[model samples]
Structure formats: structure tokens, C-alpha cells
Target: MNSPTAPRRDDRPQDDRTAHRTILLRGGDVHSPADPFATAMVVERGQVAWVGSEGAADAFADGVEEVVDLQGALVTPAFTDAHVHTTSTGLTLTGLDLTGARTREEAIAEVRAHAAAHPADPVLLGHGWDAARWPDDRPPTRAELDGATGGRPLYLSRVDVHSAVVTTALLDLVPGVADRPGYAPDAPLTRDAHHAVRAAAYAAVTPEQRTRAQRAALRHAVSLGIGSVHECAGPEISGEDDFTALLRLAREEPGPRVVGYWAEQVAGARDAEKIRALGAVGAAGDLFVDGALGSHTACLHEPYADRDHTGTAYLDAAAVASHVAACTEAGLQAGFHAIGDAAVTAVVDGVRAAAEKTGLARVRAARHRVEHAEMLTPETIAAFAELGLTASVQPAFDALWGGDDGMYAQRLGTERARTLNPYAALLRTGVPLAFGSDSPVTPLDPWGTVRAAAFHRTPAHRVSVRAGFTAHTRGGWRAVGRDDAGVLVPGAPADYAVWRTDSLVVQAPDDRVARWSTDPRSGTPGLPDLTPGADLPVCLRTVVDGRTVFVRPDE
Candidate 1:
């Protein structure tokens, strides 16, 4: 027998060896389009080396340094969350969670307890309180919160994050907040007031606190099999220090990749340069064209059913057009947060005008995105296809606020509510779809997100699980102009996850399609059974760029 010896420095550079560690994963289902029957895969050099059956895997078994026996678990591309607020998500994860508090009294009690528990925290912050779902259907008053916190500074954002109710003590922190638009002495702040107050509240977060929060959020994402997240940071949402620190931390650690988007308008080359300097991939994300529907602030052509007037309009067609044109000329992607029909109309009209000025080919090639495009008309959907725009949508919106009796229906009436989040229409019209959690707003449940899209409340809007899965995976990469990643092809980036699932099954929007897809000759691979109430696949391992970023304990 040959004597064992330590690895020699002459063999290969340490960094190169670490980056290109050879591994063979076999005895499992490999969800690769290259081979529907693939039971094994070879990963090397931060990329997928090959995928084939277990019988073929024997050829590479002797050459690899490590072998992971999947033991019938399913392997798939790790999800990419196209929209997220990293710091806020982290804060919410570690702070007071009011999402489960059902009534105004219950919410206040939770806040009181949270404040009591964290007396050292300069400002008491909480999130995910939706009055629409409450039995009382009334948000806790600022005065009530004042009494609950014993006059401490308190800021509690609504579920949508578009509006927030702050105690008078917190209000005092923002100078002249009473003069701001959308401010009410006792009600939740919206528009300019909401923006100002949110900025002030988040500014109180220390750098150490911010870094801890960011690390928590990114670490949580990896545990859920998420390989990448697009951070939607802006002046109104978070400061430059917060955004930059989060990005720096991600780069310095082994975690999910962070694609940053600074939500600011670009008027010229200088503006675009400033955005690029922040390490943002685009001058896009939460560039609010209007507020959210639940807040009754979403820009609408008609008045909201529960409210007396049309919602707030932050930017008109002219402003949107100018921004798009400037971004196109500067070779940067321009996007917006548009949730209402009127807002979607403005985006379509503006992009069309931009296409006219900058040449349709150039505008189309840029692939600008529209976040939370939930209220798109057929005309706007067609325009999205024509303009080559990407719809960065959240299926959880429909899962939570859609349906006959949900918040969307309450705000827009049932007829209009039926039209929200038309994923099938967008797909049929060739508008690209990228799925996300909007995190902190919804959550970082990748499988749940896919299931929500596949089983949308509106049957007309529902898509097949495969389509939803693809959107959550490959579509996010395409949104950022990368056509080569987010899959398990031979040359694609080796970003994938292994799941311990009950069973793998082919699912579709209907029984007929499901039957056809499951046929033996169809050459389709199976996914976890995502039927409503069925257990979601649990992550056993997650790898990004051929590096193991997360491994389930006791596995």
C-alpha cells in the first residue's frame, strides 16, 4: 500500500484548489434539463462539470476529492429572490414580530412587551401589523401606542411598509413632520411623511446593529436555499451607509450573493455614475411611482372603493419618461415600484416614450424592471412585452391580499381585484417574470413563493409549478442581464440546493397538463409535491459558486 502524505504546495495553489474542489453528488435525483433521468452530478471550478445517470457517474467517482451521497434527496438550482430589503429583513427577524397579533389591543400588548424587553434600544421598532386582517379592522392609534410605550420613541410600520404609525415621541424626532404630505397627527404616515419618519427611525440604528441585522438576514436566506437576493435600497428606504455596509458584509462572507439596486432617478451621466459608485446594478428598485394599495395610497385612475378619492401619484408620465430616457442614454436599467393601474399606465407610457427617443432596440436591450406590477392592464402588459420590461413580482401579495374577500378586493372591489397579479397574462404576452418575497414584507420562503405562484388565488393568474420555479430561479438572473446562471447545465454557475422531500411529482395548472407532463416519454423531471397543505421541501444543503454556504444541522 502507498504511504499517505500531506498535500504538497507544488500540486496547485491553495486558493485555486479551494475554488475548484472536485465533488461528485450521486444516488439522488438531479433536477437538470440536460438529463431528466440524471441521478448524479459533478461540480468543479465553480461550475457544473457534468450531469448524467448514476451508471455514468462511475467514470468520475475515482477522480473527485469529495462525494456527497444524496440518498434520494432532490437537487435543484438554488432560488434567487429578485427583491429584498436586507437590513429591514434582519431587523424584523430579530425584533418585535406583530404579524400574528390579530387585533389592535393584541398588537399594542405585543409592542408594550417588546419595549419592556428591550429598554436599552433607543427606538422601539416593529412590523407586519395588517389592520385589514384584524377583527376590528382598525389600526392602533398613535396615542394608544404612546400609552403602550410609556412615551418612548416607537415606530411600527404596516404590513406593506408604505405607511406607519409612530408615537408622538418618535414624531418629535422628525423635524416639521406635520408639514409633510400624507401626515396626519393621529393616523399612520404616508407619502413624504412616511418617507421622512422612516428615514429618521432607521438612522437611529447603529452600525454594529445594522451589520448584525444584515448578517442575520443573509444567513437566514441561505438556510432557505436562497443563493442570491437583490437588495432594494434607496434614500427614502435606507441610507448609503446601511446599503454599502450590507453589500460589503456579503462580499466578505460566504453567503448568498447580493445584487444591489439603488432606487434613485437618473437625470444625466453624473447621476448614473453616482448610482454605480454605490455598487448598484441599476438605478432601479422601490423608485416609487406610487404607494401601496392597502394603504389606500396606490395611484389609481378611479377612486378606491373604501376611500373618497384617487390615490397619491408620486411621479407622472413626464417624470417617468425623463428618468427612463436618462437611464437608457446612460446605459443603466431604470425601474419603478408601481402597484396600481394608473401607475402601471405611467410606466408603460414613459417607457414607450423612452423607446422612441433612445431607439426601441436600445431600450429593449436594457431590460428595465417594474417591481410589484400587480395591477397591470392587458394594454400595459402588451406594452411591457413590446418594451422588453421585466416584471419583478411577488406572488405572496396575491396569496395574502388577493381573492374575493382580501384586501385588494376591499380596496378595489371584486371586479378589479380579479385582475391583480396576472402572471399568466404576463407570461402569455412574453413579459419576463422574476419572483421575490419583498422580504420583511412577506418572507424568504422560496418553495412557498413558488407554490403561491403556482396556486394563485385567481385561477386565471395561476401558472404551472415548473414555470413558477423557473421564474424564481433563472428569471432573476435574466433580470440582472445574466443569461448564463441559475440553472444546473454543464457550464452554468454551480449554485444549487439539495432537499429532503417526501416525493417528487410533476404538477401543472390542470389535470390534463399534469398527466401529459408526467408521461414517461415526456422527458420532464419532477419537483417536490407542492399541493396546498403539503409539506415544503426541507433544505439539506445549499451551494453557491461551488461553495457550501449552508448545511442543515444533524444531516
Candidate 2:
């Protein structure tokens, strides 16, 4: 229960306990994102104690234990990824990665190379193949993968993580799966069938492998200027054991902080107890209302332009309302993964019903959130603002598969697709926005997220660069009910990143550079110009709660 100005405790003398082990970062542009003129910062214990000009360092030097020269590196609050899969993203770091695969044949070739390297793996597990950008606009079929692995059990997930393809041998492991809903003979599995296949595919990994995977993911987050990550865990996405292991690792080991959310459709006391037992922040984080659009499973109001399917719904309005009400009554956050207008409408209806059942004040106090509210109308946005909903969105989704000739345009026609992910409109309507990269699905790049938000495919929906930076930084902390974190103010958590960067603006002036400077309109400072082609900063250090989670070695 530390106050805003209370310093963290230490075993030092009474006079020193209030401010122990202070360190000053000098000669750097301290763009707390809110404070543009601060050229120096003081980190005491695990909190920011002071921020001022570099000349002020000497005033605190007597009590300070260390003074590190920044050499003009940009210092700012570390990033937080709102929605991420812990082990799944980790496995991609060590397993088959097809993000560079340009064609269907190239994707299969990567599988062949991985199979050749690991001839003894029980089941081949990999992800990140997208057919949307391929010339043929098709993914590698089970037959193609079987040829790569010589008929061995294999499961390859799509970039969206909503659909996956499994070889016959792997499909055989889950008996009678072909007869279930969302089953195709030898093509990619979607909906229920895909979940079953994915579970079966991952069973081959032992506990040791799972631990390594989680570690790899955390370390990667640290190197990328990320201090914390919200793990979107579910029974379908990653089982209870995987979630438990991840939380335990963050608690015991030195790495990025992890806030766990169990994505379960809780309807009663029993489910609430389950979430409490798991020590979760909420009962929803990808609690699927529907699947992803790339998989042709999002619960859209209209049928797909290229196909006759209208998409699927895992939870109806009643289910959503019941879950939100129960979670609200039990003093926990409720969230859902909703991607289509139909699903968005259902969620809005459910929120309204929950407000009637449990007082709107109580519902708002819980600070319930929604993931990927990508397709929303004006009414839906208004409901979100009324209910105090936090829209945990990924702007990178649009950068990768949006615009005139993208996957969204192919599935949904150009007119319908053009209206997706209205970030600016959401902000204007007072819906709190938090930006993130749903890593592995999209790479975990905070700068890239900000760039995409500022430069959206739809010009009218673009947010200011300052707004995008705030969403990725302070807004992420607010989404998890921690207004005290993610800023560089005194008494805030000493969670920040030091970066090695070049030009701060897109078109640099010949005489001067625009480092973490401010835009005249809002007065809030912006991060380095993160436009698509500009060079992003390199992380030199990442500190979380005053501990050095990552530091680049002098090479």
C-alpha cells in the first residue's frame, strides 16, 4: 500500500530507508512521453523518485549509489503487450517459423527443413503461415505437409491462430474429429475441430520443453523494450498447466512481469472460484465469442463475400451477459475476444443486460475489457464508453492485413473492410483504448504498433502519434487496473527502456534532430517517429520494478 510519493523499503538505516540505493540516469532525453523537458531521472529501489535536468544529478549524487551516462539514448517507459500467448509465441522462437514464406511451396519447404533437423520429434508443431499474401492465396494442405514430414504427425497453425492444418497421422490421434463441426477432410481445421487438433499436437511437448518455451518468450519481451505482458490464456489456447507454469516462472524467475487471465466463460460461483484458484487477473482474455476473421470463423452480421458461410459463434448473448454479470458480482474483470460486427453487437447487448442485473457502477468498477473489438458500429462504441470498457486492440493487425488489396478486402468486400478497427472514432466516443501486438500472430513491436495506429489504412481512423504512444504505454497499465504503473513520474514503478536510436523524425532536418520532442497541438511529447520505413530504436536496457531484466552486453 505505497502512496504516490512513498519510496520502496530497504534494510538500511531509518534516515536511508526512505530513499535507498538511488541511481541517476544522466545526459539523456527523458521523454516520459508526458514530460518532454526532463533530461535526467532518478530510480530509487524499484520506483522513480525524481526527474529533472542533467545538472540536478549532483544534488542527489551524495545519496545516489550509481550514476550511469546515457550517451544520448532515449529513455521512456517500457512497453506492455495487452494480448499474447506465452508458450505458443515461445515455441515459434525455437520451432518452425514461416513468416518469411512467400508461397505455399516455400512454407512446406520450411516444414521439411525442420523435420530433417528433428527426425525424432513425436509430433511436428509450428505456426505462422499466412496464405492471404501468397500468389495462389492458399495454405499448405495436409497432403503437402505429409510429403514434407514423410506422413509423420504434424500440426501447423495459421498466422491468425484461428485455423490450422494437420496431417492424417496427426488427425488419427484425435479419433472421429473428421465428423465434428468445422472439419474439412484434409484442409485446415477451424472452430471446435481446430482446438482439438491443436491440443493433440501440443501433447507431444514435455514439461521441460514447456518451461524453456516460456523463458524464451519472456526474455524476448525484455530485449524488445517490453517490461510486462498480459498472457491471454485459455483452456483451448493453452491448458491450465501451461498457465500455472508461466505464472510460477514470473514469480520465481527474473524476467518480464506476467499478468495472467484465464479466458473462461464464467457463469456462476464455481467458475469464479476456478479463476481465483488460478490467481488470475480476470476470467476473460480471449474467452472466445467467436473465432478470427482470417479463419473465416468470425461471427459477422453478413455472409462472407467470397464464401457462403456466415461464420460461427461460440457464445451467444445470454452466455456473454451471464458471464459479465457473474464476474461483476464477484469483483473480477470480464473480457472477450470479439472480432465481427455481429459479435460486437452481441457483446454490447450483453453488457447492457449485465448493467441492468448488476448496477452499472459495479460493472464499471470492475473495469471489464474486450479484445479485438475490430468491427464495431457507432452504437457499439457508445455502449463501450457507457460501460467503461477497455478496448485492448492490436493496430498491427491492420498494417499486416488491411488496406485496399489485403486479406480483409478479400474476405469482406472493399467497402465493408474499409470500416474496420476505428481507433480514432473509439477515442472520440470516449472508449478507453490500449494498443498491443498479439505477438506471434503479429510480431511484438511496440514502435510498429504506434506507427500502424498513426498511419492507419483508413485516414479518418488514424490517431495522433502521441495518442498511439500513450495507448501502448500508460493505456496498457490502465487496462489492467493499475493506474499507478507505466509512467516515469515519482513513485511510479521504475519500469523503463533505454534505446540506441538515430533520426527521431521521418524527414530529418539537416541541422537538428527531433528526438522525443512534442507536437505543438497537444503538448504531450511523442516517441521517435515510428513511421513504417524509419529505423526503430534498439533496446540497450529494460528495467522492471527497479531490477535490470535485460541489458545489452558491450560488444
Candidate 3:
């Protein structure tokens, strides 16, 4: 590693920016591929200057302006969440959250309390209530919600965000929503009706509220050691105004970097230009090819075990091909929200067609993404690798609902559930895997996400801790076409986090490999112990571009 030499006294400026651009952090374990046993690192001008042992660090101790004693902490690359809904996540942070409610009664009680507390609010919005977790598997009815809110307008989204239940007052805001597809007089709304009501509810949020929510979400992410987040904004998800506002907020603030994606289909250069004008990196993310499985709306080849229907299909293969071709031609990334088997099949066939229509090299070079590719087949997984599609997945999905009795099994039967989120298969086939939390649907817990993948409910899908960590960090950067960021190495972006952790150990999907690599002679770096039920590492500090973004309180 090359160390930065000190400038002469005459060349060194008195200005803080010039003098303090270099910082040396020593006396800690640095997780870096550059040096597996790295003990110290130097950051200069928002980039990693060098990484070496403690003795080597002494050579340039006086050259840097600031010296930090890491005091045995573990330093690793800050995480990048590949899929996120910024404003909505913020709203959940500031508004009502029903993630902890176990039964229908508990969810109703929480809603009533929130409505009573915020009496003056125009529309009460809440998220993360799963009927599948309830004893009777019954969602809160519209009548029950009406009584809970005392006729106040309310919209409560299911855990998946694919469907929601609303009070009649909120329903009144969307004209003819009752006649929309997937609408029922009693149960939670799905498909078109769910989208209509969700839009109406979010429209009621004031500009100030929206800003507060966005700030809260970003702040929460940075505090958890997340350095960057990809905002998956779209027309049906959150309007153009909301998406642009979030990008502006992230730019003006000193928080995690926000890479925006407008999930809109493109026809040609004009559409791509419009997306770029909105400050988006791609015209991709959450462009719904199908809804989520929890709502029984994920497009499947066969009928769901519980439901007689095969679920919803928002976009067909032809439409997906057209979108992919347009994006490839325009040099913009095209992606979709596909979860079910049929939806995954459509994405594979469509991208294959696009690669044939547009030059395969160009299509592959774009590195387009697929969000929540949960139910992938071996064929589709192979196609993803062939087409160079990045799987921006949330491992927390499996943690929350992937066991024998979890929601996946309930919806798709135990046999099909085992096939969901085949990370091992995808990785083995050379498909790029980018991990995310899909916050608001699942909380932004980076370490938890890594652990979930490392200790997947299905043993066949689990990956090593190191691989999982890389998927959460560097893989996200690669998805955004950035090869130099998201790692601790010379000339790479100085985005990292300091953690208070237990003894580091090499953990793998197989116990034998983990045991064999524990010796220092193995040259394998270690991460915090992530055995099931073990306490996760705590973020002591998070830095982005050589600037500290979060410092744990009372540390």
C-alpha cells in the first residue's frame, strides 16, 4: 500500500479543508480485501489513501492532520441498500407502524389509538399489518376500521405493501375505486384499487410532513451504518413530485447518498431524457411486473395452494421486452418488481428478447436490475447471469417469512416455498446479488440482513457471511455501475463504519469451511459472530466520503 507523504510546510495551507482532509484511523481491525490483516487506514480527500498494519501506519502518523484511535473496533465498508422507498419509509418512521401487532384486534387497537392521538390529521396512514400472522388469518375489515377511526379517513397497508384496507371515508376520496380490479366490499383491497387508495392517502400528506419523513428515514439509515440507498420511486408508488423532492432533500442534506430510480417504462430517448431530468440514475426499480405473494397477487405459473387463482400479472413478456429494449438503446437501466415464478419467467424471456433485438453486449453492459426476485427458477437464474441482470433482493424477506410455517409456505405450499430466494443457486450461476432491506416492508437492519442470508431458513440458499456482506455492500455499487466505491482500498471511496463487535470469526454456509478458515494463517478476514440469536454488532460511527455522518450517542 502506498502511503501519502506530507506536504512541505510552505505548501501546507492553514485552511481546515486543506489541512484536515487527511485522517489516520489506527488500532482496529479493518475489513478490506486489499489486506486481510489490515489494522489501520488513511483517508485523504474523500478517498482511501492506504491500508496497512499498525507498524506501517506509524511511518505516516504525523503526515495526516487527524489521528483516531479505533480502540479495537472493527471497521468495514458502509452498506448500500439496493432497494428502498424513501418518502414512504419516512412516513412509516414518523407515522403509525403496525409491524408488532400480532392479531387483528391488536392492529385495530393500535390504529384506534393512533387516530385518537392525531385527531386533526386529514388521512391516517399506517403500514406492516399481516393477516397471515393473525390467529384467524383475518384482516381488519373496513367497518371495523371505520369504528376504530370513528369515521376518520384511514389507510392501513399490509406487510407487503401490495394490498391495504381502508376506511370508507378514505375510499370516498378515490372515485370509482370500488369498481376497480381486485376490489372487494369487505376484505383488504388489492391490485388497482389498492394503488388508487394508496395514492389518495399519500396525497393527503403535507409537504412538511413528507420532508420530515424523508429526513427521518435517511437519518435512521445512516445511523445504522448504511452509507447509500437506492430510492425506488415510481408513478404508482409515489408521484413524480415526491420522488424529485426526495432527491433534492438528499442532495441538500448531509446524509446517506440517494441513488434514485424512476420505475417508469420507456419507449425511446425522450422517456429516458425525462427520467434523467428528474435526477434518476435509471428508469427502473419497482416497475411492477407482479405484486407480492403475501397479497396473493404475485404472478405464478400454477394456482396458489390457498387461493384458486394464479395471481395478478401487471406486465406481460412483450411489454417487458419493449421496456428493456428501450432502456438498453437509451443506455439506462431497466428493472422490475417480480416475485412469483411466472413473473420471473417473463423477466428472463423478455430480457433475452431485448438482448437479441439490441446488441447482447450493450444489453449486458447496462447491468439492469430485478427487485425482490424471490421465486427464481434455475433457468431464470441462468438467464439473469447470461443477460447480466443484478438481483437487488431483500434477505430480510426470508427472515420474516420463509420457514416451513411462514407466509411463503401458506401461499405457495412447502414445496414451492423451499424454492424461493435461491441465493446459492443464483450465486453459483454467476448472477450478481445485491442485498437490501426493502425498508417499510422490512426494517433497515443491515447486519440482520447479512445474518439472515448467512443463516437462511432453507440451508440450500444460505451463503457465507463474507459473501453476504459483499452482496450488501460492493454488489450494490456494482449494480449502479460503480466499481471503485463500496470497498476499503487505495483510491476507493472512503465510506465505512466503525462497529462495537464481539470477537470476529469467519462464518460460512458450511460449518466445516468456517472452522477451517478460523486460523489467521488462512488469510481470511473475520466478521462479527452471527449465529442465530447472537447479538448483532452495533454501529459506533458511520462515515461517508471521509466525513462522519453518524456517531452513536453516549459512545
Poorest stretch of ten by lDDT in candidate 1? 1-10
Across residues 309-406, which tens digit of lDDT does each residue of candidate 2 receive?
Answer: 87999888888899999998877789999999999888888987999999998888777889999998888999999998899999999999899899
Off by over 4 Å in 2: 1-20, 505-523
Kindly list the per-residue Cα lDDT of model 3 for residues 1-555, writing each as its tens digit: 110111111111223463238999999999988898999999987789999899999998778888889999999999999999988898898889999998999999999999999989999999999999999999998899999999999999998999999999999999999889989999989999999999999999989999999999999999999999999999989998899898888766677888889999999999999988987878889999999999999999999999999999999999999999998888788899999999999998899999899988888888888999999888889899999899999999999999999999999999999999998888899998999988899999999999899889998898888889999999988888887778899998788999999789865445522342466765777888887777899999998777777899979
Task: Please tell me which model should have the higher TM-score, number 1 or number 2.
Answer: 1
- Superposed by TM-score, candidate 3 places the C-alpha of residue 291 at a distance from the truth, in angstroms, of 0.4
Residue 179 error, candidate 2, Å: 2.0
Query: 183 in model 2: Cα distance from truth in Å?
Result: 0.9
Q: How accurate is candidate 1 locally (lDDT)?
A: 0.89
Error of 3 at 76 (Å): 0.3
Q: What TM-score should be assigned to candidate 3?
A: 0.96
Model 1 / residue 514 / CA error / Å: 7.4
